[model samples]
Target: MAPGYALALAFSVALLVTTDAGNPGLVARITQKGLDYARQQGIIVLKQKLSTLHLPDYSGSYDVGVLGNVDYDINSMVVTDLQLPSSEVTLLPNVGLKLTVSGAYIEIHGKWRVHYLFISSHGDFELKVLGISISVGLSLGSDGSGRPTISTADCSAHISDMQVHFSGGLDWLINLFDDTIASSLRDNLQKQICPLVADAIQNQLEPVLRTLPVTSNIDDVAAIDYSLTGPPIVTAENLDVQLKGEFFERSHRSPPPFSPLPLSIPDDHSLMVYFAVSEYLFNTAGFVYQSAGKLIFNVTDDMIPKDFPVRLNTSSFGKMIPQISKMYPDMLMKLKISSPSAPSLAMKPGNVTISPLLDIQAYAILPNSSLAPLFLLNLSTDAVAKLGVNSSRIVGHLELSSITIALERSDVGPFPVQILSFAVNYYISHILLPEVNDILKNGYPLPLLDHIQLSNLMLKLNEHYLLLGADVQYE
Candidate 1:
């Protein structure tokens, strides 16, 4: 592998490059291209190496440390008198040549630090980001092996710092919450890094003073360093705006224990159907929720009249008995409705947080949409018998292993919906407080991976998205 060989290719990133890609502008072109390349590579490396790179939580105050290694390729080069402090950072120690067609290899070699190249490490904060930060610096200079000779005054695109912040969604934030927002925030964060990267490149290459080809397309053929000025979009226009906030039990520790429910019910069961169903969803169904609370919901007045009577099912109640001895696993939650009067259902174990099994799916809608739920509900607890309005109540029981649903109508948009959510079923274990205690106590799905691989890590933008709508302000 060469020591380091980096070049810049500038497409119209919502700016105007009214100059040529000649020696005068080469510095800026190279610096910008170098920074661009470095950042892109950094993203891929970060994702591929996420398993190996561990980090500390930042929900509160905690110290973080940088512990990992990354590799890159460049021509063999060495630099002396480099001012950078970190020895790990590699930069231009050997100059590259771009020969002309006349001299076989029209190699164009110059003496200048157009873009400062060097690697340096810096401390980072979680910043309520609940993620980790990586900071690096780069510089450009001549290899120390050669004698001082008059060349171009090597300019430098000193990336004082380049960082990639990382984090897991809400589930990982706490054992109880199955926060779906975590994954959304992760994607938004990647977008936030784009502008910072663009600035880094601009700083490094603005002075290279190189000329560009005369083609109408600012996004030109592959070359080491390049520059163009036009209205077309580039990688720089992918913008994202995010507002991150979270609600968690700042106090960590198990909750006080509650006595088990009696396995009996009254003879009359009516108004208690709603609470019975709710409790069934939480305690029996092992649903994910923000906190442990009594089951609650409303039932159709006709479904159970004031004097309606029902009987409890004991024989069929033995099935679907989940181990209720674990704490609520870290998971994401969501409430979806499709109509105004339709009963709204809450789902647990977000797609991003839950285990690969225990199927749980969730989707979001706008303010006016209603909810349509499909679940084979089974409620057999003796608590349902006691939740009666008074006069009389029976332990109305329901048991179903699975419930499939079909949507009547929906107004949701093009945003992607993730249904492959599975959270560690902590509700059952949490309430039972004995069965799955071992599983929760240990914090499962332990790091079973040692290494990671990336076969086709790629980025391909469609023609429509490439048309940038912003300005480069390339001063």
Candidate 2:
């Protein structure tokens, strides 16, 4: 049950939480349907553990009416077959989880030796245990490092019936007292079951929980933080976990400028898990790249297709402002386009938009290989992004909704701002956006637990956040 226990502790550490905007940026919910799957896996693991059980030798002396004093020892008991036909997992609301197993049956083979004063009889025996039942309650919490911790709150095991059959000379005499021997065996078996369960949780499951990566590198430039913001929230139908799903620059771990907005995920049992990501996650990415100075790009004439009507040179600008044709004719030009600040994202019920402030500096090449400053334009735009999940990452493309252009400074003298606006908008729509889209097509990685895969996913845009509902497959 290590895997099942790991899954439970990993996702099951909460109660009703406050709706503070500073609440966890990431929230995941595990429904009853998910618990059912976990229960199935748990039973398989339990059976394997029980099959290797080591029961201590049982030896005792008892007096039988006509047989006088009889002494018997049952040793080297080995489990031959075990069956767990019924089990269930139930959420205990504020208490955590309770697992109950009933109707379990087990068969054991062992050696028995009995002494009756003058003679001793030795042979093999069969022990059948029936109506076995076990119940365990688990309490989940987190350690200082944000890793989940699991401890057994309460546990119990019961054996309703045990029958022993002996085969050997004078075995008939021992059979008459087998009921008394079986009772002692039943008591010993019941005492071992719960302690083994507790040890498995402490020794096997707790270590796996520590292996969860709270922070993982997404790429060379950035890494994501998936640490729990606080303890989990528990409801009758769900176990909710909250995480600080923010990305930071690899070299610098500065916090993002904005805080996560209040996010919520409805109970959807059909899916194994539900992940709700806030706008803060995307904005932190913008901040990381902006702070890293990786958001800037230099566009040259060589990058433009030769067949384009307008070239990136003084000659092309001269068509609009004739003064440029007399000064630097046939000279090439360069545009250094970069964001002055981190772009901000705005999400609403059916739309997700972004506003980025950019500074585009145009320069003309001089005969001496020096750059002659032409003009500078401050650009801002309203763009909407179409998002999709690819593999474990989120991939998206931006669509320009509106553009704003302003002349900040110029060395070639003043020209009508309206004149360059058309060309600027056209350049952005046809050239710059395509390049941005190409990079966005690669997408950013999403934080996920080990060996967990998302399938049958659905993404929904809500006010201030994005909800991703998916069925999870544990490898």
Candidate 3:
């Protein structure tokens, strides 16, 4: 309790503190200030990572191994074989700093240990980086350049389980993966692997993130070559199309009549011609197409030169049928038509055999309804008729093979009157009974319809089309 005794006791304690090697339970306030300086370095690393990398807020736990050393002036001793357990590292609410280190472990030349870390800052990332090896060194000189950079050569680490979770929409996910999803997924995953992400953390980013695949549209859809799979093929709609083939045609005219009682059958005069087109298109009612299938001499607005030749292939029917079925599923119907045999005849007293292909176009109309509109589309072949000149007052023989008609529903709920499709085939022969004395010898006259017949044939006119159908009342 005396002043001299107290002074002596303090000196002894100080000496003991200075000499306390190989001793336990001794705590000393280091005047060296190494821990604070190390914290500043870690903070600097964080700032650089944020500003340059634009990283997302992160929170997780990590186990950091501690490596410490003791250094006084130029003399130094290295520390190793120190280990730490995993601890949580959370993002400081409202801060974006990622703290791999809450605090650091220190070893005085492999002799002593002390651990410490910070809580957090907002809008920053703080995380307990699992299995991260942390090393703290004492600087013996100014500028803190004497400490060693963390090197795998001096330490090691191992991890059992690891995972990462993030939130945001597609673009947010993009930035997380650094603007490229594939690259991001790869880099994020690689971040889990120890050395690459860890090693690159100081130099460059190598985070491998997992990515998902995408198909933007049908074009992106690729067909698998299963034996059953193929490029899409055409089917339906064009199943049954008649009236696009070779056809023999005949026309007849009647002579004048003067009898008052007016009950007389006129004589016959007819011409025979064959018609064909280069190509065909199954289209809207009477979408007449000619010119080798390319130039559409559409009957609606397209007028053909009187001599324009075109081929009408049955193939066009296949294309048209599918489209038509899609439009008129319920009301349209088709039935096949065929004749037993074609009739044979001569037009100009010469030997000629004409087998004409029959084609018909007709329409059906509902009598009374909102939809009671006219749908005049059909194809049919009439029975062969024969009349010739040698019977000379007679005409020709006519036969037909098949006919088809595709009718559309107008305002009518269903087609009201059906127009039977018909094809007419005919030829001229020498009339033996008439004695051949007339001015137009063996020469058959064109089936020129008289004014009465032409006037009697009723046809409705529209801005774009003219329709003729089944029960057309000649008005």
Please give the ranking of all candidate structures by TM-score, highest first, separated by commas. Answer: 2, 3, 1
Off by over 4 Å in 2: 1-21, 117-120, 367-370, 417-427
lDDT of 3: 0.21
Selected candidate, larger TM-score, 2 vs 3: 2
TM agreement with the true structure for every prediction: 0.14, 0.87, 0.15
Per-residue CA lDDT of model 2 for 1-475, tens digit only, reads 1111211111111000022247677777778887787677667777877777787887888888876889988898899999999999888887788999999999999988889898999888899999999999988777677766778999999998887889987788788789988888888789888887888778766676676567777556677677776666666889887877776778877777778778767656787777788777767777777787766777788777778767789999899877777788999988887788877777788878777787889999888989988889999888777877754666677788998889999888888877888778877777777766665666655556566677887888878788877776767
Best-matching candidate per lDDT: 2
What is candidate 3's CA lDDT for residue 441?
28
User: Which lDDT values do the candidates have, in the order given?
Assistant: 0.20, 0.75, 0.21
The model with the greatest TM-score is 2
Error of 3 at 335 (Å): 18
lDDT of 3 by residue, 49-111 (tens): 322222232222223335222111111223222233322222222221122432322121211
Tens-digit lDDT string for candidate 1 (102-194) = 100001111111111243222211212322333333222221221111122222111222222223322122211212223433443334333
